[model samples]
Each structure stands twice: as C-alpha cells, then as structure tokens.
Target: MIKRLICAAVFSGTIATNVNAEELRFTVWTGSKAHLDMLNDIANGFKQTHPDVTVRYDTIPFGDYVQKLTLQMAGGNPPDLGWLLENSAPAFVEAGALADVSKTLHATENYNYADFSTSAMGLWTKDDSVYGIPFSTSPFLVYYNKSLYDAAGLETPDQRATDGTWTWEQLKKDAATLRNADAGVWGYETVDGQGYSARVWHNLIPIIRAYGGNAWTDGTCHLDSPEAVKAIKLFHNMIYVDGSAVPPGEQGDFFSGKSALTVTQISRVSKLADANFDWGIAPLPAGPAGNAATVGQAAVVAFAQGKNKEIAAEFLAYMTSAKNVAKMAEFFPPARKSVLEGDAFLSSNPAITPAQMKIVAQGIENGSVLPSHEHFPQIEAKARPEFDALWSKDADIQATMTKLCQGIQPLL
Candidate 1:
C-alpha cells in the first residue's frame, strides 16, 4: 500500500511539470528571414537554460503595430513581448503598457547592464525602472548617387565631408545644379518621398535641429521660432522655388535612381542590393548649428499585461545581453557601449565598408533620438495640416509654423 501511494505521488508530480511548459508570443515589425533567424537562435539559446519554454514571433505591419498591439491587450490577448518605437516609448511608459524589466536585467549573471550608454538608454528608462531596451539607434545619413554626382561634374558629399565643407547650403547648391528636368530626375527625396504628408516631422526636424531649433523645449512649442522658420523656408525653397526636391504627389525614388540624393539610414541597404547606380553614404550635412546627428530608434519591451511577464522579462534580458547585442549588430545598430566600442560593429554589415560604418558609429555616439512627447500622437495630428501647408511656394512660412504651434501648444 505504501509503495503504490508513492508511485501515484511521483506520477502527479510528472503531470504538473508537463503542464508548466509555456510558449511566449513576441511581436515585431520585421519579416526578414535573417532577422527572424537570429531571433529564433536567441530564443533557442534561452531554451538551453529554461528547456520548457518556447517563443514565437508575430510580424506586425509597421503602420499598424502600436494600434494593433493595443487592440490585442484590450481584447484580452496581449503578446508576451514586443518591439516599441522611440516615438511610442514615452506614451507607453506613461500608460503602464510595458513591464518593468529592471530586476531581471540587473539580476542576470554577467549581463553588465551598465554597458549600455546613458544617452542611448534615455528613451527606454525613467529614474530606476527600465521599461525597454533599445536594439537600434540608427542615425539619419545622406545617401547620394555617385553616378549622378560624377555625371554632374560636382564633388561628392564624401569628398566634401572629408574636407569638412559639407553643409546644408552646399547641399542646396548641389541639388539645384543636379536638377535635370528633361531627364525626369529629382535632386533630392525626403524620407522615402512621403515627406509632405506621412513623414512630415521626420522630413523637417533634422533640418530644424541643424538650424538650432527644435519641435519643443521644456514643454514649450518652438516650431515657430525664427531659426525653425528659416529651416522650413530652406526646404520649401528646395521643393517649390528651385524644384530640386521631389514635390508632393510625386514619385522620385532614390534607390530606383530617379533621385540624386536622399536622407535615410543604413538599414535601407537591402533596398540597394540590385541598384543600377553606384551610391555612397555620408554623414548628415551640418547647418549653422553644427552636426546634430539625428537618430531614429527602436527597442524591445515586455508587455505589462502579458500572461507570462516574468518569463518574457527573462527572455528580454537574454536577448539584450552584451553577446546577443553584438550578434544583432549585423542588422541593428546596438545601444550597448561594449558592442559599439568593439571592432565587430564596424564591419557588421557586409554591404557597407568599414569607412561608411564609421560614420554610423560616430553618429550613434553623438546622436540624439527623434524628439518625443507623451502626447506625440496628438501633436502629430494637429501639426499635419499646418505642415502640409509648408510644401507650397506661396505658403507663409512664419505664419504657417505659428499656426502649427498654436494647435500643438495646448497639448504640450
């Protein structure tokens, strides 16, 4: 009777352990095989320690990522972990949508949490609580067609950068000279050619910062500041006056060779794989204020409302460990100080040379993430029409920007 009772007890323990096995669902915006393969490898690494867990990544469209994630939470089914854009970090942190991973991050053996740069971590942390970890702090760069520059008989941005003569004024001059109306080529394309509508802030903020202005400072709207007005006027002239930039409702793709120059980042290299023209990436041109090195960032976050918060936080810690981060640097610019300072990051991307990668490293070191506010969505909504107005030749630059501030000030 005693032996039978002991056997029954052992069987029940086995059943309970089997029931403990859990699968975590992760959300991401990338559907790239290389990215997914790396992620799966990381997950497999986690299983080496916690053999009972499984991780699955769900690809969300970039346009609907935040909204759909929110809906899933509201519908009682939230992803255990997910990617969050820098623009959404402030709002998500304020809304209590992300789990606090500080404990897991710090308690992990040899994690070296302090290896992350303070400037790079600013958007993901508040006081002592870490809500997210940035995986990419990609800087905006100037990608110019070498073929176009050679044919136009002009010194390329790289040459200008080497001599410390690259500036917004020089960029304007090059754009004007490169304009070839008969051949249907544009001199410049703004943020994937959706500048006038979708990427309105992205299209203007770098220029605004270069001119020593910002969207806001200390809860005050400064879109109408004289410096900002001057910056907007410069881009307006590029689009309407000189007709050097691709105007609204037009298709001028830089990767497709229809545009001479574009301002973007290294992640777009895959788009240039089969390009017809030779291209080179240079640091962003300096304005009167000097190099701003504006960056767009993204991070990984564990959802506060997830069913498996503890395990998700553990996975987050593993995924962002120094080794894993260095591994991810092949595709994503890492925020880890150790990785960024090492030799691996310089040659991570085979498509780009070490020289061009140096510009990326310097940019991340000196860069600031895109301007963000807790009420960013509201600010973006109110400024859209006013921003749209700036694309016209007859637009009143100062007054239009003033109106933008008026609409955004109440939210700020």
Candidate 2:
C-alpha cells in the first residue's frame, strides 16, 4: 500500500497521506546557517509527496566527518543518507557500505536521470550498479580582488580571460606585481591555506593537468614527468623566488582581503557577500596544454545498513530532480546538464552576475573531477612527508617528485 501510494503521488506530482510516520537521518559536513536553511527548505518540499516523512540533518565537522561516519556505521547506527566526498567514494563503494539506488532512481517518475552529466556521474557508478548521486560538481576558479587589481594599475583575471591572455605565466607576473610588503598583503593563496598539507593534491592537480601531466594513468605514476616537474617548479619559484604565494606556515586569506587572488569553488562566494572590496570570478589560468579545468565533487548516498533504505532513496530522487537541482544551483553547483545550461542557473545567485556564472558553466562542461583512488587516505599519508620536503628554499624539484612518485606508486 505504501509503495503504491508513493508511486501514485510521484506520478501525479501531488501529496500522499499515510498514518504511519518515519524520519530519515541525513549526515552532512556543512554547519553554515544559510546552507542549512536552504537544505531545510528542500527537505520540507519532500513532504508534499511523502507527507508522513521527515528528514533530520546532522552536521559533522569536516575533519572528523569520515571518522565519525565510519564509527556510526560500525556501531549499527548509520544515517539513512549522507553526503560523501569524492575521495571517500571509492572506499565506501568498495566496502559495500552504500546501497544500490539505480532501481529507485529509474523507478521515480519524471526523474529524467539522463539529465546528469556523464563526467559528473563517473565516481558513483560501477558497471551495473549505481551507489549514489553527485550533488556538487564544483570547479576550481580564480577569485580575484578587483579593487586590489584597480589599485595596482593592473588588469583583473576576468579581463584577461576575455582577452585570451589568462595563462599561468601571466598569472605569475601579476602575482609578483601585486605583492605589497608594506601593507602585508600577499599575491596568491592556495586552496584555503591547507594546500601544502590537507589539500596538497588539489593545490597541484590543476596546474599539473594544465601542463599535460596527470597523477596516474592505467596504473602508472606520472607525477615525475617533465611536464609535471615544470609545473611544480613554477609554483616553487612563486613561493621562494618570487615570495608571492602565502607560504606553508603563513596566514593570508583572500576573502579577508589579505591576499589578491585565490583558487576556490563557487560556494566560497558566500564569504564575499559582505566583503569590503570588489571581487570577480574567472577561469583558472591556462598553460602550454591550454586550460585543464578540475572539479571537486561530493555525492549523496544511502547507507546499506539504513532501516529506511527504500524511502531514503525515494527522497534522494526527489531532492536531485531537475527542479530541485535548479533551485540548489544558487549554493551547490548542479551536476545536471539541463540546469547547468539553463538561464535560471546563471541568475540563481544575486551576488554573482550571469556573465560570471557562465565561467562556472563552461568549467563544468570541460572539467575532470580531481584524482581519487581506493587507497587515497593511505596515499595521502605516505606522500605527506615527501610533499613537506618540497616546501624548502632549495628543494630539488625533479628529485623530490621522483621520490614522491616512487613512494606512492606502490599504494596506487
């Protein structure tokens, strides 16, 4: 009776009634009031079809997320649905921790499952089974301080992106020109200041990819390739030679106006909402191989251990439908091709204009998700000390990369 009612309501796009009530627990890492508010709105909308169902969102700090979630699953108290990072996807899917939602997704009426991009869906799928749905397929972009650019008497990234001169070399020159020792302002900040450690891969992949270097291909390591070494050398020069990037221990926040540029996703735009200076978003600088856009993705998954697995998958389908994905484009960039190319997504956020949003759309159309492996955590642990070795003034770029690759190749 419940299944028939759900199918009927979903097909008719109307409300269904049930005397028995159920609540789903969904875990996520974001604690932002705005993000929660938007999420709550979506959750409430789900009651239109499943009138007796309720969704409760649990917030976990990012650093402790995977650990706590693993504990919950081990303790036999896993969330019905949860948001899983790209790096964790392979591990979770391999362990059979996630429920297969392909049947539920395909069974939902008017779902238009094909609207999601193939690249965006790559991580959650394995042959005949689908374990999750990507919720955020955000791309790396250059966020520039337009006010600082104007004060420095230099063109901003957006202007250069328009003129076809926004290459990595040009960015390096701009960073050098904008460095202001007297005011204590830095030229560039990498991926939220954790680039050298926690976000080391995110810090290097775009630059490496733009230079035609890849982390690995078909089980072979390429971090020591000539293209990769050159890319690392350029960044190394920026830190020690140019003294432009905020170094390993230093503090410089682009959103706080202490840095002139940053590489981040559209979600960070909320940080600039009340900024004291003008800002704009632009595509990542190009390289010899042209621009190689990189994306960071997160997916919504149902746990295999959940008591409410079927209903959880139904709600997942509801939340990620084309209409809701369009609504979510304001904060979480959508993976749906229909929403991404639509005019509504361009104007979804009041803080960003349509023109600026187009850069994000183009990036989604071309970008590849950041590197992920089943052994990512082990690889990150083994590669940390090697990465730390390269932060010094006279670190040998070629030798360090060669050593780093040797250590991680086995883990891969």
Candidate 3:
C-alpha cells in the first residue's frame, strides 16, 4: 500500500509539470479601448476552460506596431501570436516569419472559414494556404448628422440604403445644399492628400472597382488605365470641380460639426456616438459598375518561432468563436457571418441599425483585398507625391499616373 501511494504521488507530479508547461504568449497591436477590453474578456474566458494553459497578452501602439514587429521577427524572437494587417501580411509572409495556420484552423469544428468575408480571408492567404484567422472586418460607410440634413430640408442618406442609389453625383448635390460658410458647415468632408493618402486610396478603390478597373493587374501597377484615370479624375473633380468635399487641410472641420457628411470606417461609430448632434450611418454610395467595396484593416497570425503553436492556435480559435466574436463587436465588427447575423451580435448595439449592418456585410463580401507586394510600401511612397499633386489640381492625370506606374514597376 505504501509503494502504491509513492507511485500515485509521482504520477500526480508529472501531470502537474505537463499542465504548467502549457503557457502561451500573444501580442496584439490593437490600441482601441473597447477592443482591448474585449480582448481581456476573451483571455479570461479562455482561462476558464483551459485551466492548464496560461495566456499572456502584450499591447503595442498602432504607429510602432509594424516596425516593432519587424524588428522582433528579425531578431528571431517574434511573439507566439501577433496581429497582422492585410496590407502588411505579404511582406512578413515573404520573410517566412509566419506559421501556415491552415491545418490547425481547419481542424477546429467551430472555426468556419466560409463565414468570413472573402476579402478578409484573402489578406492572409498566399498561393492556396491561409496564414491567419480574420478578426475585425470593416467597410466604409457614410455618417451624416441628421440635424444638419433635416435643417437643410434634405432627405436622410439612409433612404438610399436599399437601392444603392446614393451615387457620387447625389452626394455632391447634397454637399452643395449643406454648405454654409457663415455657420462653419459644409456638405461633405473627407481625409485626402499625401498625409492621409491611404484614406483617399481606401475610398477611391471602391469607385475604381465599381467602374470595372483593377488597381493592379498581373502583379503590375495598373492605376493608369482609362477606367482608373477616369476614376482619379472624378475624385479630383469632387475636390476641385464640385466644391463639395472640403480641401485636405480642412478635415478637422467635419469632426467639429463643420460638415454634414463624412466618409469613414464603421469602427468610428463609437467615437461619433457622443457627438452633440444626432447622427446616422448609411452604406457607401454605389459606383457605375453596380457594386461597392471598401478596404479592410487587420487580422490575427501566428509566428513561426512560437513554442506553443498548438495552444496559440487554440486560443485564436476560442477568441474567434461566435460567442467571443459577439463580445468583440462592441468595438469592431467580427469577421464571421455567423456572429454578424446573430441576434446577440445585432442586439448589442442599438445605435447601429440592421440595414446599416447589412450594407457593411455586403460591402465586405464584395470588396477586394488590397494587394501586398514586396515593394508595396515603395509603390505607395512614390505614388503619394503624384496623388498630392493631383489633389492640388496641379498635375496632369495621364502624365502623373504613367510616371507613378513606371516608378512602381521596377519595385515590383
């Protein structure tokens, strides 16, 4: 009997050691307050079911996230798990710093790949393999001050949500109606120029795609095509010819109620909730090709050097589960269709309407993921000066785009 007790004690000690070995470290660059709170909740939830495993989370600011992540990867000490933006994933994937998470994600029963937007999935896939599970997925929407619109005797933008009739032409007309210099208000405000060139690119890409133009073709820059040139010309016209959108330097006016309409990400709803005026959101105005699209932000990935890959993947699975994803929607929309369509997810935020959510869902489903090549950063760098010139109405569209493409081609 004494010998049996000794054997049982040794077995118990072995189990304890095994359990203690199952710890994971995850790094996320999400800096939003609501997102961080939801992440903590998910972590705590994981700990409940996974008593043997411990998860440690580290936060990084958005500005330094990529640079810091790159440095850590170069030093061969990347976190067990990290957040990867769609625009930045290709570069890291090319460096072989990310694990091919396809198999692990596929093995999980509740982890449904089909439920995520194709564009969201496209961001983390190279060739035929997927590297990450999508997290926050957003699409551009029109946020308008209802008081401003009503005071101007204008119809609410939400009226056009179902028919996709909110065109650039209509938006311009509405902007003209709302402009009032004496009251410090304008019809529309958008972030443009080199300082916020990505914002211009984000809004413009949908228009380009809607007009049947590909931003890049066969791994080469194709922004100089007839359709693309027309798209750029129209965008330029909005600021220069239409007198509807505020100039680049005047973006702050919109946040201060100087503009009636602002094109922004759905994630900004939280920020706008406390504004002095009543606000409403509508789907992005449709373009010529009878479709709409928007740029997506970031997803979650696993590092190649992670010691606890299995546990890391499990944690990711748990975090992205429908229940957990519903919690995350308090900050940003979850990537899963199941979560997006569920009553729990929809009922959490009464501020966002079901119609608006449908528009976002459709936009994400139809959206194109931004292409990420090795020289993408370089391409963006070279293109910005010309885009700035275009916005300032000083550059010839054809000549500028042609030159920009030439500079980007060599990088590709």
Name the 10 consecutive residues with the lowest summed lDDT in model 1. 11-20
lDDT of 3 by residue, 1-412 (tens): 2122222332332211222347666777655666566677788888898888877667876555666665554444556787777766766666565678777778888677677767557667888677787777767767888898888787788887555567766777788788776887777777322224545566567667666676687777788888778877776776777776777776535556778887776666666656788888876776676655665667778766666667877787787777777877765677787887776765566667766677666666666565566545566667778777776756598888888788778767
Model 2 Cα lDDT, one tens digit per residue, 19-123: 123988899988878788888999999998888899999999876677677766664466889998898888777767788999999999999989876767888
lDDT of 1 by residue, 183-203 (tens): 899999998677776567777
Report the candidate with higher TM-score, 1 versus 2.
2
lDDT at position 88, candidate 1: 78
lDDT of 2 at 356: 88
Rank all candidate structures by their lDDT, best first, as comma-separated numbers.
2, 1, 3
TM-score, structure 2 vs. true:
0.91
- Candidate 2 lDDT for residue 310: 91
lDDT minimum window of 10 residues, candidate 2: 1-10
Tell me the whole-model lDDT of each prediction, alpha carbons only: 0.84, 0.85, 0.69
Instruction: Name the regions of candidate 2 deviating beyond 4 angstroms.
Output: 1-21
Residue 96, candidate 3: C-alpha displacement in angstroms: 0.9
lDDT of 3 at 217: 74
- TM-scores of the models, in the given order? 0.89, 0.91, 0.81
Superposed on all Cα atoms, the candidates' RMSDs to the truth, in angstroms, are 9.1, 7.3, 9.8
